[model samples]
Target chain A: MIEVEQLSKVYGSTAAIQEVTFAVEPGEILGFLGPNGAGKTTTMRILTGYLPATSGTAKIAGFDVHENSMAVRQRIGYLPETPPLYPDMTVEGFLHFVARIKGVVAGDRAKQVENALTRCNLLEKRQVLIRKLSKGFKQRVGIAQAIVHDPPVIILDEPTVGLDPRQIIDVRNLIKSLAGDHTIILSTHILPEVSMTCSRVAIINRGRVVATNTPEQLMAELAGETGYELEVEGDIALAQARLAALPGVKTVEPIVDSVEGSGEPSRQKLRLSLVTGTDPGREIAAVVVNSGLGLYEMRRTRVSLEKVFLELTTEEKAIDPETMAAAYERASHRDTEPPILPISVTTDQTTDWAPDRTQSIKSDETPIEDETEASITAEQPSRPEEEP
Target chain B: MQSVQILFANLMAIYRRELQSYFASPFAYVIAGVFWLLSGFFFVAILLGPEGLIAQANFRDQLGMTNPPIDVAAQFVSFFLGTLSSLALFILPVLSMGLYAEERKRGTLELLATSPLTNWIVALGKLLGALTFFVTLLLPMLIYQTIALSAANPPAPFTGLLLGHLGLILLAAAVLSLGMFVSSLTDSTILAAILTFALVLFLWVVDLVGNSLVGPVGAGLKHISLIRNYTNFAQGVFDSSSLVVFLSYVMLGLFLTAQSIEAFRFQRS
Candidate 1:
């Protein structure tokens, strides 16, 4: 439902976003991840029709942002990084004004306002001036304004920015509850926000999208050597040698045995960690049992989204200010190359060890036409499988 | 129809907010209270005191100056009315400072900008709200003027009376419109108020400075002076040129206010 093609924005010496292209299909939540000043706000501003892209164009639900801004605005509800508010006005007064300007029907406006206030848990504060509210409450009021119109596409810029942890969870849960009915472009640099809420994650750095995939796919693709941390009772040297000798066992190392939690005084458990080119967990288990070594427990540890995001973005972080600005401008407008790289992870001789049942291969089969609506909270009756 | 609807909607919003602010704060009460008290003192001084207008044998002494008098009644009243025009030079900026300045400062202006309404609707709405508040000060003064005119020995110049009040209303509208336009240029109400006062006061005195000139250059300057245009109305002559001039000023200020808001759309992008 949204297509951004080679959108780029250039300010005299800096590019806010660079040649960034990404799409959102109906009923999908796309996480817009980036560091501070990484063109996340700039990109959202362009999509929300708040700013003109220096060069490229973005379309919302097939309506060109620049060419048909009013139409695009009508279809999108944007909660800017700062919740635009009038401190002097009461919550009810402010929402009433917003409803009028947003073109809510005269008869429906009261109902919409009441519903919005209730949804944000602001019904009682409706008569209280916004200035008297705490920061978290003000933020909720901001979210209330954006969603009061109930536009299909909701673009929230750092909705959780200043809220306390509990309030963050409150807003996060609110976003999740709305996800099924509204396509959301959740822009935030907070890594866990994406993993927890968004179905697809796009990592943007220095104004360009460096990578994007489901949280799980990103972890699986970037992963290199699989390792099993095992605790066993045996002669340490002999077990290590035996595990190394097994097929597909690339290397073996001893991990320090920290038994503080086990409370077994003077009892030692030998730890064997291995980088394996094969299904060494099963093979090594057989070898160890055959050798009469006690195998207590074994498990694989995977890299988290935080680790993957930092690694991919840091490599491209050395760009000059001029290039960085240009890239941000370009990325915001998506004016250069499509930042979309096919997340093609081919399971080669790797498929022989398919017991990692949590693995689901990502299909790059997503077409560009359906990006915007795909992430909405509304159910996509036409789409059979909305997941990537 | 679209423009009309937008204008009415924005006007209603701004008017309600501005009116609420006026009553909630002390600015309106202060402006009106101070003005009436001052005007009241001037009124009592003229008709009741020893060297009052009652004993002058004509309204000439009501002018309130001695030997080759400066017509201080008209002068003091003009100063009183000048205070009306001058208070406009001051109070208007404060009233208008919130028009677009607060909206932009708070970032709520985006809600208006993205709406289907054009900039002029919002501009006119704000202009009208401030003008409505301004009228409160002028209306009472007009009532006093009517009382003074009726109590006169031979009766006051009806033409001058009507013209003078009309001139005052237009001046308030013009000043408030200019102030609102200036407010739209920035997000800081303090800056908007300061700049607006400086600009309006300058325009008011431009005519005074021009009138002081004795040569051909002065004559040319007086024609463009804002005070000179209002002087004719004070004396009771309804000159079309002056009326047209005031209307043009009002329109020009509104036009620029609209343009100022329009410029934000580009700058913000």
Candidate 2:
């Protein structure tokens, strides 16, 4: 129940956010994904009525955020990047105070505060002073304050930052639990948080939304390639030739760094780039064994959401507005069902992959960074599938 | 009717929170203890010491040189209130310095700003909370003054005596309001306190500079001088204009604080 149209906030000369547009349906958790300083906080601040937009408009629950700020504010709960808390106050006291300010009825404030304490798992610590609590508990208190009034729309900015891994998972589960009855817009720089929690992901870079789609659709459409890297103990050239001859095996090339220049080493690494929607792992293994090559190791490699985020945010000139609109138009044309929302920006580089450019670029200089390649390949097994 | 009731409820919520913070912190108690010690010293030295007003009046009575009917009680009330006003100049800044600056530093201003409560309500609530604490600070001194004044040969006139104390409260309300405005301008409480002290000090003595000149400009400066209006108040002149000036200062401070907070929403940081 939020609509932002061409919202732009300019500070002196530099625009913090430019023509940023998006929408969230009722009960939908929209992940506002972006890197640091990518205007995620700026956009959220504008939506929360904390900062006024220079141009355009934002409406929450049908009330204009700028003109009808009080009404809009009454309908939404906001957790700033740094949770606004009074350290001297006890947890229950702070929530009671917040519930009052948020206009909850005096009769219901106690029950609402207790409800929030229970939901955030902060009941035991309600009597403790906020200053004495650890960081994770303080974060829970922050979340508790936001939800104490139980407003329909919640805007959380980086709710999981600075928490330990276990705390992050707990906070994510808490946010997920909040999604069915409350519409949530959670902004975070963490890739997996969005994938694990949000139903729809909007990738923003340089104060612009480059893509907005379901997390699965985003991964499947923009994920670079599904391929395999094999380390063989015999006849690397013969293994490459036999693998290349197989159908749907797009290309098989020897990994240069794994080769011994002076002599035929006992082991070599071979990389195979397969066409999309092709799984020839069994055929390739049989081909290697029948070709008198011993396959020591074969690892599946695909672009993870981290790579998709990097490709969206870090690529300096990959997406301009016109190309984004053209790409969105092309995507709409290719798919029969309309996009979930009015997607103003999206990428279509996947549908127009250039094979000649792949041939020109060597394996070592491939677009994927070495660290990302290793991490994605290592994490291939325990990939989080929708987090239940 | 319902809107006003809601407004009052919101205002009291903020006021209670502010008062609770003041009472819970050792720093406010430390300030109160120092105030009690200093004001107690002044009270004893001015009224009971060897070279004090009561001692001088006694010496005059023994000499039997009846120059005029000197009302020692009226003189003491006026003199003590003048001293208290100057004493308040220092303590009120410390009280008001953290009113908004602390909120800004801790990021709680975002909560207050984003909440449905109006800016003026928050300002007024905070001002009332601080003013209440300042009154509690004065209560012990007020108790001793009342006991001392009760023993006067002819009971001190309650009108002038109460008027002088009213002047003290108004002067405080004025100073605290302005200090709250200054606090909203910066996140540094120390800077807010120092600047507020500077501004109050300038307004306290503007009549001195006003006396050096001649014309409407001089009259205007002298008219707005806080010490002048406070003296009128302490002397029980019943000047409605002085009341307007003190009230105008309070309203001006509140108005400016509200405007500053409204402008803060558009500020870059």
Q: Pick the candidate with the highest TM-score.
A: 2
lDDT of 1 by residue, A180-244 (tens): 78888988755556667788988887777877788666544535334454556667677778877
How much is A71 displaced in model 2, in angstroms? Answer: 0.3
lDDT of 2 at A130: 91
Q: What residue pairs clash in candidate 2, if any at all? A: none
Highest DockQ: give the candidate number: 2
CAPRI-style quality class for the chain A–B interface of candidate 2: medium
Task: Give the lowest summed-lDDT range of ten residues in model 2 chain B.
Answer: B260-269
Show where candidate 2 strays beyond 4 Å. Answer: A222-224, A227-275, A279-388
